[model samples]
Target: MTWRLFRFFLFQLAGASLGRFLFRGSSPTQGAILGLLAASALWVLIDLRRGARLLLWLKRGETAVPARVDGLWGEVADRTWRLIRAREQKAADSEARLQEFLAAIQASPNGVILLDKNNRIEWCNETAAVHFGFDPKKDVMQHVGNLLRDPHFAGYLAGDDFLHEIVIIGPRSTASRPVRLAVHLHRYGEGRKLLLSRDVTALEQAETMRRDFVANVSHEIRTPLTVLTGFVETLQTLPLDDEERARYLALMARQAERMQTLVNDLLTLSRLEGSPPPGSSEWVSVRALLTLCEQEGRALSVLLTDGSGKKHDLRVEDAADEEIAGSQAELLSAMSNLLNNAVRYTPAGGRIEVRWQTLPDGRAEFSVKDSGPGIAPGHIPRLTERFYRVDSSRSRETGGTGLGLAIVKHVTQRHGAELRIESQPGQGSRFSIVFPAGRVRPLQPV
Candidate 1:
């Protein structure tokens, strides 16, 4: 402004001096035209200066002036600020929701893992850590293949057939009660994947047990039914002597008895499993229980005895006359089964020892150890299973129902007792039932 004003003033002064010197008789019209020209130039200079200042202020991060009147620039600025604030608020909300989702997944029981396009682990929940024996923090970004080296899992990942899921045994399956894992993988979002794992160990075991139980029951029933059918057919189709007929009838009767016993045992197991737990009830004397068992054992001995008196040897060892609070009938049955099994399996001249003793810890152990052909180590664990027999031929010959041990097991469990089986092939087996101290009762004075 100042420089332009000074230039104009200097020009006007020069013009006036020249007009006076060159045209002393000039008219006032020329003076008026010069003054108008100077004023127009000054206005142009002032406008130019204003524009330069506005540009400089804008470059220096100052607010720009309104391009138009009627508050248009103000409206633009307000809308831009509001848009930025709304976008920032939306981003914060999204982050919060993502955190909540992650927390929910972390609390889930099933294992969950997220994989990137390269098949590397991007994220995993804590349950996944427990399932796969992995460190959730350190294993991030590691290839799934490197951490899980199981051949089956490796194949699953590499295989193109991913429409279906697979079930495999997880880590610590053998020792830690056998955990079964159902793994499912899904493709998502441009080559990314999600892997979900669930523990189905209990479900799988229950299914297997149900199938086995059904199959076993069928097989057990069919064996006797087959014999009965054969005998009936013979009786109907052929004329037989009285002695042969009697023998056949006896065979049929034995088979029928065997089938009945198996059915009774199955029913007993079902009842035990479904019934309420045993309560503190009538007190039964262990001595009396043993006395009853001895009577039954002797009867069985007589049945199997040969004329030489060398077929069965039964020995009864009386420990303290301890009493236990439980169902007397169940206890008697448990004791009688053990004694009978011992007598039946022990060879001629082989002794069977039955003991009812009180341990120092106040627990009572009713043990029936026999010199019979001992069970193998593998068979001992499953000896209590229904219809499980070490020697099917011998079991039939001895009138063994193959459910005696199973009954004992159920009875002991109902009474809070422990059944310990010690056996080795060719060394004879020892079957003992240990009743905890809590179940033991003080004996009444005779």
Candidate 2:
């Protein structure tokens, strides 16, 4: 400030000298007045030039700090530069945060979409793009309704009701591998909206399975219970001969046994689902398992033949002396189920071969091959489903509760084994459980 004052006074002095020289014959008072006027005009002009430079620098939006100027103009330029730098840094931080937030949304399993006031898509996560079958780049600014043509979703968007979520088949859904989505919209930010979608196909299928399981169990138990009740009533109300009584008692016992088998299978399945997977610490001998299966299989085959002198060509070939790791009871149950299924399904006098062999890959395979009527291709995939049967009547005649394959499947999965089924209609069926090398090892000497 002092320097500015000094320079201003010096300019005035110079202007007075010049005025004196120019007006040498004029009066001193008039010359001094003109000199002061000249100095004031020169000061104004210098200030204007600095202001013009400051204005030009601002217009250019240059990041470089302005050079020092005199008086209030220097202070004004410095303050302006500081404000601009702060604003730029704030804008950069905001951009970085926005990118971080978008990245988090992209990694989410569920779909998220941002829509403008006009219902056009502003942004969407990768999951949303996949769910809606959209190109993330190309689909921006496109109307949501125009891209998703589902009538249900269109109606949902049009309606004012947003309290409840609507289920819709996603754009990528197909008949075989259907994709179900639960979608809802939340109004936000002045008429704009957030669209949230989650894949619910697995949940829907599980619910359907639960319903079917309950219905099937009720039917299975009720049928046998009804028969047993009828038999009991007959024995109590009517005077029956000894032979009739014995036959009725026998039939009732069979029904009771059938129900017991069904209950036991249901328990096994529950336990398999609830318990941790079987580990490799406990091992069961393959030879022992086959021995038990052979005894049960022969008995079941004899019972199915009903003493008509019909017998199966039952063969047990144990080429692998490996020990399978798991619960002994579970292993036995799984192997027995496969063997029993073979005996039940194979016609009398058909060939049935049970083999335990070690593959070249060090995996041990327990296989049951039967020359009975092979399952159709369509039925093979669903054979392991609970209570699913190719011929329900035939299965009943064979005294099967229809839970054998399901139990086998659960046991194999628990033991880290793969259940492979090969069958062609009218040819034969081969059911194999291949145990991983980690679970199978050469038998240790006792």
Candidate 3:
């Protein structure tokens, strides 16, 4: 400020000297007045020129450092530059944080979508694009209702009530391979919305299976109980001869046995589901398992034939002297189930081959091949499901509880083995449980 004041006075003095020299005859007061006016105009013009330079810099966007100036204008330029740099840095930080937030949403398993007040899509994560079958770039600014034309979703968006989520079939859902989504909308800033979606196909299928399981159990138990009740009523009310009484008693006992078998199978399934997986600490010999299977298979065949002359051509081949590490009882149960299934399903005098052999990959397989009617391709995938049967009436007649394959599947999974089923119409079926090399060891000489 002092420098500015000094410069102004210096200019005034110079102007006054020049005025006096130019007008030597003029009065002193006139010369002084003329010098003051000239100095004042020149000072005003200098300030104006500085102001104009600052305005031009601002107009050019002020991207670079401000130019050097003097006096008040210089101070103004410095302060303005600092304020602009601070604002730019703040804007950059805000943009970086926004990108990070979007990246986090992109990594989420569930779908997320942002919408404008008009229900147009502002942005969506990759999962949301997949769930809605949308191209993220092309779908922006498109109305949500227009893209998702499902009646349920359209109605959900149109309604004011957004308190509950709705379930809808995804756009890519098919009848054979279904995709279900649970979607909900939330009202956010100034009437805008956020949409969230999650896949619920597995949950839906589990619920359906639960319902079917309960119903099947009820039906299975009721049929046996009904037969036993009728037999009991007949024996009590009728005056039957000794032969008839004994026959009725035999039939009642069979029905009672059937119920007991069904109950036992149900218990086995419950245990398999609830218990921890089998460990590799206890090793059971393949030879021992086959021996047990052979004994049980023969006895079951006899029972099925009811002591008739007809018998199965059952063969047991144990070519591998390997020890499998697992619970002895579970391994035996699984192997026995496969063998028993073959015996029960195959007709009398048909070939049934049970083999325990080492695969070329250092793994061991326990396979059962039977000359019974082969299962259709459609039923093969669901064969391990609880209570699933290819022929329900035939399974019942053979006194099967319909939980054999399910138990086998659980046991193989627990033992880190794979169950493979190969069959075709009229070509018979082969069921094999392939154990990994880690679990199979060569038998030691005793």
How far residue 61's Cα lies from its native spot in candidate 1, in Å, is 24
- Can you give the lDDT of residue 223 in candidate 2? 93
In model 1, where is the ten-residue run with the lowest total lDDT?
64-73
Q: Each prediction's Cα RMSD? A: 10.4, 2.8, 3.4
TM-score list, all predictions: 0.72, 0.90, 0.86
Report how far off residue 362 is in candidate 2 (Å). Answer: 2.9
Which regions of candidate 2 fall more than 4 Å away from where they truly are? 1-49, 64-71
lDDT of 2 by residue, 1-446 (tens): 78878988888998887777677786776787788789889988999988888888888878666646666688889888888889899999999999999899999999999999999999999899989998889999999999999999999999999999999998888887999999999999999999999999999999999999999999999999999999999999999999999999999999999999889989989998899987788988888889998999999998998776789999999666778889998899999999999998898999999999888998888999999999999898899998999999998878888888999999998888999999998999999999898998888998
Q: After superposition, how far is residue 25 of candidate 1 from its true place, in Å?
A: 46
**Residue range 269-315, candidate 3, lDDT tens digits:** 88888999888777888898899889999999988976567899999
Please, what is the whole-model Cα lDDT of each candidate in the order they appear?
A: 0.82, 0.91, 0.91
Give candidate 3 misplaced runs (Cα > 4 Å): 1-70, 241-243, 444-446
lDDT of 1 by residue, 1-446 (tens): 57656866776666555545544467655665565566556655765665555445446643333322112233454454466567768988999999999999999988999999999999999888888988888999999989887889889999877899899889767863788899999999999999999899988988988898889889889989999999999999999999999999999998999898888877877877788767876788888888889999988888777664675667788756568888887888888998889888888778888988888998889998888888888777788887789898898788887888888999999999999999887788788999999888778786
Candidate 2 C-alpha error for residue 15, in Å: 5.7
Q: Top model by TM-score, which number?
A: 2
Instruction: Judging by TM-score, tell me the better candidate of 1 and 2.
Output: 2
